[model samples]
Target chain A: MGKRVGLEVTVAVAEAVALCRIDMAGVYPITPQSHIAEHLSNLVADGKLDAEFVTVESEHSAMSAVIGAAAAGARVYTATSSQGLMLMHELLPIASAMRLPITMAIANRAVSGPLNILNDHSDIMPQRDAGWIAVFAENGQEAVDLSIAAFKIAEHKDVMLPVSVNIDGFQLTHMVEPVIMPSQEEVDAFLPPFVPHATLHPSRPVTMGAFSMSDYFTEIMKAKDEAIKNSKKVILEVWDDWGRQFGRNYKPVETYLAEDADILMLTMGSMGETAKIAIDELRGKGVKAGLIKLRLWRPFPFAELAAVLKNAAQLIVTDRAVSFGGPGGPVFSEIKSALFAQANRPAIYNYIIGLGGRDVAVSDFVGMFETVRADKAKAKADTYEFWGVRE
Target chain B: MNIVENFDLFAPRLINKKELFSCGHRACSGCAEVLSVRLMCKALGDNTVVASATGCMEIVSSMFPTTAWRIPWIHVAFENAAAVASGVEAGLKALRKKGKIDDRYIKVVGMAGDGGTMDIGIQALSGAMERGHDMIYVCFDNEAYMNTGIQRSSGTPMGASTTTAPAGKASSGQKTWKKNMPEIMVAHEIPYVATVCPSYPLDFIRKFEKARSIEGPSYIHCFSVCPTGWRSPSETAVSMGRLAVETGVFPLFEVENGHYRMSADMPKKLKPLRSYFKPQGRFRHLTDAEIDAIQERVTAEFNKLTQKAKFL
Candidate 1:
């Protein structure tokens, strides 16, 4: 650790990327994610980070450029959010299909119909199948740590897939928090120079993104699926190494006072801290309420999540994005699907909460817990309710 | 003997250099696009990487487990070839500066069809050029979306029959004239921009060679004849490309730092537009009035180019 300084989460993200010594960055400006681009350009301009900063006209080009840079054996970084991520949707699978380890930071925001540029997971939920290793950050420190760790995990020899760190828009990205930024020397030691598995070079020629017909398309997709599934092992090891080096431990499923709790609340992103506070208040009232936050979104962490929630009697899963006409929120649906066949599983209730930056206070969490505890029959397994929605 | 010797003087040199692009790929029998690509690759030599767009060239050249390309090549998507090439150049630059790779100059080239370059891909191409990336962008102008069965594209010339813009009693085939992509590249104020036709193989090679030496963005718009899309005989593909330039339909020129110069000498007596359009089945429906209209437009465009070249 170098020093604990108050820094905006986006700046910390840029600093983390700078420490990693990226060779190229192609970024487009989008709301709630512009600071990352701005700070990165500044870094490149100031001669602090020796990287080519290409101001791409749009998110599509940004992703395309990053993919190109990665294919050329460059350590590349980019950042975007919400509509920007949606704009990059077409190239997302291509990046993974080509197996370019290009890391991107997504300041997660609500997708627009009414155009809400605020915190939500709606943006990344659609990209869950885009073949990228998606991770979530709870706050500024995790944003910094994961921003750095994403490069390591993505460039790992076993993995070589794109990694996206989702920092919740506005709530986390705009907020200033004390973060222990690792030194450049420490980062250099942690992240070895990126050795590309295969690169575009005249000396050693290779064809990437080749067309696949029906005869071999299924096999190619199956191979990609296996690659992502197997990436979990590398993610875990990288997180473990980070914990040992930095003294701040991280896990796929993090529990807060859930040792013997009868009721458990599940959350993702910055809402976890708020849920923890609610858990503390419920504990003061002699209620056995605990919190569980999912750090790894993609490759779902099924076994670890199942082990953690096995003992709970009830689990309140909060989602910031709606599935709209589906049974519940995206995360809720995944959790239900994961626990569907289990012999002894908790009664899981999903509350779509804090959507589009609606303030989710401690009182809202308490009310949600009270409602879940009061309802004995547990409603239905696949049903969800909108918490704190007016009328 | 004198006529044979003169013809031999203009023939493309069969150098001992290996073909970076090889046979056994799946292009159409008389594809001028592939011919142009083959010649372009030959000019670029071994020290080059290609970022190709999704089109006929990409689909035909890079089937999984087989590739026509002997050099490093990638097909990212339809509209991002220029953007991708920008990334490749930047990545190579970083590697070379860091002493991670030998400091030999390697060329980055972006290849896309007319639809990819003029339609959905315009933004990426413009951005890459504006950023002054050390790369070459080659747009094979077949003038329609031939990969998707000849849909009308912005590059489609006026009065041309296509699936999307077919000729009828009430309407001419394509309402708009072919978009001038070389002028658009020149507007970007890049270091070099040129127009070439595969029929002139030596001229094509020379333009690409000059483009490769340029330090900044260079654009090459090649007027490729799509015999299948244009409903012409397969054997007429090369003749069609030659007819396009000789009839003043598509001028072969280069713009170096905004200085426009014609690559080939202008025809002393321009061929009539009818001779160029008569053989193409897509233009068979054209009436004499329509032919006259096309002739007027071609002559006017050619004159405008001649004036620009003279001023430069």
Candidate 2:
């Protein structure tokens, strides 16, 4: 059994990465994500982690360096947030297309224009089509577990794709909580050493990142799409193995008092925990309110979501980022598309909450439920509103 | 200083005979850039990994399902080959230290064109050199962006007409002086920095071999001639490189540990710059006054370099 200690989520994540015994980490610091990079560099400097810590100049070079390290058959890791993640956007798809198993942590924050460094999903929303297996964490414990599992999942023989473990920027990354710090022996037993499918080596030469023309571009993209879609099986298997080993089990979509409830509120990231409090308060008041927390964002658990929201009459979907001039929020658009073909779909309402780290408290969750209930009669499935807007 | 003294016309036969960069690449018929790459690969031998930037060489050598590279190669993006080489070198070092991989001495090499090196890639290159990675970065300087149809780059010489900076009634083409990349690299205080042209194959091979022997970062700026982009005849590719050197437009020199050394037997007096410019259509639009001004600047720059070699 691992020791349970109170540590900041970012520190816990760095500790977990050290336990995984990565060969290299190319990191550049940004707001809210600097702690993870600092802790990792400190671990390398103290001789606690036997890895190369490359202090890259920018997030672009950070991503590029890791891609090269991974291509050289080294187990590599990196972390960034907000503008830094935006800077890394160019190389994200390249890493996926090349099928390099590079693990990264995204401290989700609001991107600039107003120049805010706060918790939001604005950072990761743009990267949805980058073809990475993205997972969200609700707390410190999940952050550590997901950071460690990300390496195993990415390095899996069948699923040779990069993975991003997203933790809400300052909300979860700075929050201190009791987390089980797994021992090196246990982590080693759980995750095996990486064996790359192809590497840049002189003995066996392979040309990677070749330019493709019209004749082969479509076929290559199709293969990449199939690879990410098929990786869900391995993700499930790894989660099951983790559950069997550790006492804590994880799910794609977790429910709280959800069974037999007619109205359910859906949330992702740390806000899901806050919504649970609202659910409990509503249940005490003799209301049938439940909570659905989405953990897996990519290779999205479509069937699992459909099964959970099957019998619900009303669903309040809250998103942290807005999609301008498009249909509501990015998540809201995807959720609507996921349930568009269903026979008995609920009246779904999307509320864009928490712009630039505005606090979404328990009362905010209750207020959303009330608004959905009052508008249930005339509500269309596609309607969305920004919650707590000044005007 | 005496690195190339023992080399002759037959000296290349004594070097590695293996051709790591295979044939059937789609470079133009008289492309000196590909020839420079081929000579570099031969000099480095088989124990090397090449990180290429997206440019003419990368596109021509690596088309999907058909690769001309017989050694390990990667082309990540346009501006990050040095950064990628740093990662490859660091990864190899860590793996060797941890006993995860063999401890063989495999050299990491980065290759990029002028646009990839002088313009978009300068930051990554400076970072890698400042970090002191044990790698070699070779800038195949074709002067302009030949792969994208002769766009103007920072390395484009003054009065050289490119597609983007065309000589016209209003403009004189490529008004700014060529960026001094080798000097910029020397400012980083890296151990080895050299300028090589394939017009002198033995000298080029010797510098590469010497760079391989160095235990730290080395920068080799290769002067490549682009006949198509320069509007010169195909057969003048090799002669063009010779003219570039003999006219002192692109001198062959080395900066080792802050000491500058010119290649042996440089001309006592450089040939006229017009002799170098007359064969190329890109510079045919240059007025006599423009050519005179360019000649004065080139002479002054060559003298300044020779003075550095003499004193430093």
Candidate 3:
């Protein structure tokens, strides 16, 4: 066990990467994610972390450099938010396709059009199909824990794919929170030295990221799909191992009093903590409201989510970003699709809330439950409704 | 023995062995770009890893289930070869420091086309060079985007006809001059920077060897003639490259430690620019006035380079 210290979440993440003893970091600056890059650069410059900090020009190059480093068998990391993540969009799939096992921290923020820089899932939503093992952290503690675990999961022999830890912008990244900083020995014991499956070596040379034709492109994509899907097994095992070692058990879909509740509210990222308070309030007033927080967004906990939502008669899903004209929100569409085939599924009602960093109060959650319970059929099962839209 | 005698005895023996970039690849007949890569790869030898950008060289050398590269190679994306090579160099440094691998140094090379290096990839290239990574960056200049059906590129010289900058009633093909890449790299103040062509294989090999021997970043701009993109007869690729140097359209030179020197002998009487431009169909649309303008610019650029090379 290491000492608990009050550290900003971004700094906490940088310290966590330092604990892992990464060989190099390729970083470019973006708002809300700049502190992580700044701290990591300081760590390398101050000789705290013996790593090569390549201050790359853009997010595209940052990803490219890390892919090169990871291909050369170095444990590497980088972080970005919003537009930076979008800029790295082209190389994200390439990183996973090459099986580089690079761990990226996405300070989740809304994508630009109005150019708003606030907490939302819009950044990571478009990258869902980029073939990375995506995980969400509800708070600073989870951010630290999952940031460390991301390397373990990504570098695992069975799950040799890039992993992204999505932490909410400003809400979680800027907050100062007390976190248990794992010691060097603890982290070393947990994460073994990264042994690359296939590295670029002159002695025993290999070809990586070969250009594929139509004949083999489908099979190659199928293999990547299977690799990410099969990673769920290792994810669960690692979570269990982490729980046993650190005494903080994590799950794919975590529940707060949802075992017997008739109504459930689903949330992801930092908003889950706020929804937990709403659930408590609803429970106190005999409304039987509960909360289900999704921790793993990719290789999504489909079975766990179905099992949890099976008992509830109605479920209110809180989405931080809107899908705009397609469905309602990205998470709501995913949940609807996940429960569409089930025979005994909950009537899921999605409320697109907290977009562009819009504040959602505890009373809003109670109101959402009241509205859903009173007129479940009026909102319709196919589409979603906005919670606090100005009329 | 004199240098010419040593080269005569050794250069062919060095390049004629089993090729690092093997023969069965799908490069077009008389493709000078692939020839440049083949010569570069042969010079780099076995202790090298290549990070290639998305271009004709990458696509032709590596089409899945088959690879022409016998040594380690990677293609990350179009505009990131230099950045990726920087990572590879750094990664090898870390791994070697940890004693996880053997002590011998491995060379990392970045290969990109003019489009990948000059236009979309310029930022990454500049960043990598400024950082001074121990890597070699080779910008195989074919003047236009040949891999994407001959689009105009920044490397495209003025008055050259490309698909994107076609010679029409109102336009005289590409409007701008070629972006000076070697000077750009020289401005980064790295240890080694050179311009070579596949027409002179001995010079290309020697430059690559010198580049790999250097301690910091080295940039090599190889003038690779694209027979298809240039709309020239396939057989004239090597001849066109030779004419380019003799005509002062492309100069063979090297800059080491801020000192510049011409690698190839200056033509006794500089060949008319028409001797170089007339052979290629790309410049066929140029009128006498445009040709005079091009000749004036080429001679002026050559004189400026000669003045700088006097430092040698």
Q: What is the lDDT of residue A346 in candidate 2?
A: 84
Off by over 4 Å in 2: A378-380, B1-12
Q: Residue A192, candidate 3: how far off, in angstroms?
A: 1.3
Candidate 2 per-residue lDDT over residues B217-284, each given as its tens digit: 99999999999999999899989998999999999999999999998746677999999999999999
* Candidate 1, pairs of clashing residues: none
Query: Which residue runs of candidate 1 sit more than 4 Å off their true CA positions?
Result: A380-382, B1-16
Tens digits of per-residue lDDT for model 3, A1-391: 9899999999999999999999989999998999999999999889899888999888998999999999999999999999999999999999989988999999998999899998888999999999999999999999999999999999999999999999999999999999999899998888888988889998777888888888999999999999999999999998888888888989999999999998889999998888888888878888888899999999988999998988888888888887778777889889999999999788878898888788888788888888887865645544488888999
The Cα error of candidate 1 at residue B44, in Å, is 0.9
DockQ of each: 0.88, 0.82, 0.85
Share of reference contacts found in each model: 0.85, 0.70, 0.85
lDDT values of the candidates?
A: 0.91, 0.92, 0.91
Encode model 3's per-residue lDDT on B44-70: one tens digit a residue. 889999999998988888898889988
The lDDT-based order of candidates, best leading, equals: 2, 1, 3
User: Model 3, stretches more than 4 Å misplaced?
Assistant: A376-383, B1-10, B13-18
Shift in Å, residue A152, candidate 2:
0.8
Error of 3 at B115 (Å): 0.7
